[model samples]
Target: MSEKVSLLTARIIDNRRVAPAHFLMTVRLPLSFATPFPGQFVMIRNDECDGPLLARPLSVYGFQRQQDHAVMDLLYRVVGQGTSLFSRMIPGEELCFFGPLGKGFSIPTGVKKVLLVAGGVGVAPLIFLLHKRLLPADGKGIMETIFYLGARTAELLTGLERLCGFCDLKICTDDGSRGYHGPVTGLLKHDIGGFDAGDTVIYACGPKPMVRAMGNLLQDAPFHCQVSLEERMACGLGACLGCAVAVRTGEGKTDYRRVCQDGPVFDLRDIVFASPAGP
Candidate 1:
């Protein structure tokens, strides 16, 4: 069946702003909601009369199951007219959304260290990964997960305090208000030395510039890096051809791949960034 078959109306259980422009919405999905992997996203649209002509695609942050009800959480920022409309939605409102879409992060055996990188709202998928992997209810976590979260300012760093218990957390603010000033990459540089490159892997989700930097830094290193890309997508599937990512080939060639299908997550070395952040 088409992935869209997973489509169902999600009833809002709660929706509130976490920061000046960031919002978190808790919603209950139908029993048939597809199980989504870390790094996957959903296309959503609320029941509105006008504007926001198309659905806005968002990352699947986290989910829980209570009795027979399944609850999913969405973390979003008000950046445009579409997201602005999303912020206005309140509890008890229903929004049409579906997911478990796109390719997600992967872990091979013998990985002892998992490094996660997030900037701004990039915390969404990484948080889900922490729960479903490192902090699973069974408490059988094998790998040590570390997070390096960054934002422009302290006020822009979302959910830093609440997620500290899940993993080794490090915070960076560009304007020197948080744990470290400058880039999160600086923190990684300071800490990456402690990890064995061969046994370490990286997962990053953030702006193009940040993801691109990661690709450049670890491309030739022993670390296996996977990056979750952010794109403005029309359809949550490949049918729209709206979200294309540049991929690098062995023969000095670049291939355009669809982010909604080929991946929201991909091997860092495979990406050909527009402006290469060379190491």
Candidate 2:
């Protein structure tokens, strides 16, 4: 929550389908809105429509400041009623939004290598972290950056074109229709040994099963790792107490933290994953 949260109305600049069921919506905000950091999210809802009463949480896919305004991109899949309403939205439509809420990723000081792992639409924030914060103008940075992306098939993968110009990109598919056969984690497991663990850090986001598998896979690894958790939220603020997650505290005690406020991003080791796999 380093950035101040504000409730404002943004006009839709563009909203179009990027993949089969995924859509990328671009909105224009006033210059007074606070800039968002990578991994931060916004709660957005179309006030004029008869959709779900509560606003849905969406990750900030991209953001850029213009001379008089700021443009933001939100990438989402059409999964249910609320999103269906959003898909029908046209340009010039106004949407109510509250954000850049929750804690975001913090790159470790002097880290020599960075790894980003994403599944499905989760690539949104990771792509933002790469271009907006990680890569330099010369297309090189002090740290060696690599991105590992995975999806059910090639068609479901988003942000591949944008990622190629920024870092080393590795892709995988579950159906063997893309770069590597099997899960994206399989690729990471194969290449992880090449890096110095002490100088490396990993950031990830995806479905619950994928995230759980990632945690279990890297539990004993020496590299520092952080993950963004996807959870249902009511109030983007901490007031509702609906997005609480169990976590291991420093004292070895279990405690509850609100995902909406305490984090959307947290140390992978601190999270208590109840299931062996799956949500």
- Per-candidate TM-scores read 0.92, 0.96
* lDDT per residue as tens, model 2, 1-279: 456887999899999999998999999998888889899999999999876998999999999999999999999998888888998899999999988999988998879889999999999989988887788878786678899999999999999778986888999999989999988888898998888888899999888888888888888887798898888889989999888788898898778788888989989898898834422
By TM-score, the best candidate is: 2
lDDT of 1 by residue, 143-242 (tens): 8888899998988888675477777888998899988997888777777768898788888888877886776667556788888888878887789888
Off by over 4 Å in 2: 275-279
How close to the true structure is residue 73 of candidate 1, measured as C-alpha lDDT?
88
Question: Where does candidate 1 stray beyond 4 Å?
Answer: 1-5, 138-140, 250-252, 275-279
What RMSD does each model have against the real structure?
Answer: 2.9, 2.1
Candidate 1 Cα deviation (angstroms), residue 45:
0.7
Task: Tell how far residue 214 is off in model 2, in angstroms.
Answer: 1.0
